[model samples]
Target: MTEPVSISLTVNGATHDLVVAPRKTLADVLREDLGLTGTHVGCEHGVCGACTILIDGAPARACLTYAVQMEGHELTTIEAVAKSGELTPLQRALTQVHGLQCGFCTPGIVLTFEVWLRDNPDPDEAGVREALSGNICRCTGYQNIVKAVLAAAAEMRRGAGA
Candidate 1:
């Protein structure tokens, strides 16, 4: 057995000191160690975005990242997307557009959209689709997902410009 390695990860703007196995994946660390189960694990590989999380405001495949390697890194999950007890514009948009069905992919979808919106708050249809290429939604067929992203972009833009 490998020795437990200590790591401090700032998640959702909260710092957590964890002692974990070096081989533990970030996904496990988030779900098991930190009890942040919103970060799901689908393929246990990098292909599926089920285990996606924001590392320093960018989406990353948590399943592929080691817990020990994330020391001092800022992590964000779906739970942290909201601020001041208000749903993020993306979250509101998803609800408004019925973007989720089973809700299994919602966290990853939210993370992906969060990152995409930061980069392109006024993304076109094709741009929205391209940005969500990595996040697969089996139930929604992606139409609502696209609509949600676009709607969220508009709302966020209005809020920012106001």
Candidate 2:
């Protein structure tokens, strides 16, 4: 058998050096080796966006991206989004708006929209829905998610202008 490939990458602000198979996806490395289960794997086909993560400050598909390719890259998972056991404004907005139900897809939605929110802190409802099209949610029918995004956006805008 071939030897495992050595990879060095930063995850959630922590440096990690792991020996992983070349075929191992970023999701596997994050969940299995790094003990970060927040990045879930749903379709595993890159369509679900359940394994979405921030690579170099951009949203990426962890399931479709191999770990070997992530060398020297910085990854941001769901755990990183929450600081000191406190939810971010966006996360809190999600809760306030009741955006999540089963919570299986919440992480992906959070990570995915987080990038968009940062890039566009003041987005309309249609824009928010368009940005969220990549992430699928079976519960709440996405109306609550849209509400949460809009609320968070409005809050952030107010803060930025203040």
Candidate 3:
């Protein structure tokens, strides 16, 4: 058996010191160890964006990342998006537009767009589709998702201007 390695991970603005196996994926460490189950594991493979999380402010697949590799890196999960207990504009738009169904892919989608919308406050439908390509949603047919993203972008832009 491989010995556990102690490492410090900064997640959601909090630092966690944990002893985990070197090979354990960040998804496992986040969900099983840290109790942050919002980052769901879906294909286990990197192809599915279900395990997407932010690594140093960029979206990355938690399933493909080893926990030990996260040391000194800033990680953000869906749990951190609405830390104030209120839904973000994206979350609110997703709900209002019915952008999600089943919800297995919602967290990843939300996380992806949270960063995407920051970089692209005025994205068109094509750009939104491209950004959303990484996430696979089995339900909702993506129409509502696209609408929600556009809606969120506009709402966010308005919020920024205000």
Which 10 successive residues of model 1 have the least lDDT summed?
77-86
lDDT of 2 by residue, 87-155 (tens): 777899999989999998999999988889988887899999899999989888999999999999888
TM-score, model 1 to reference: 0.94
For model 3, state the Cα shift of residue 138 in Å. 0.5
Candidate 2 stretches greater than 4 Å from native: none
Error of 1 at 135 (Å): 0.7
lDDT of each: 0.88, 0.90, 0.95
lDDT per residue for candidate 3 within 46-126, as digits (tens), equals: 887999999999999999999999999999999999999999999999999999989999999999999999889999999
Question: Which residue segments of model 3 deviate by more than 4 Å?
Answer: none
Ranking by lDDT: 3, 2, 1
Residue 155 error, candidate 2, Å:
0.8
Lowest summed lDDT across 10 adjacent residues in model 2 is found at 1-10
Query: What's each prediction's clash count?
Result: 0, 0, 0
TM-score of each: 0.94, 0.95, 0.96
TM-score of 3: 0.96
For model 2, name the residue pairs that clash.
Answer: none
Off by over 4 Å in 1: none
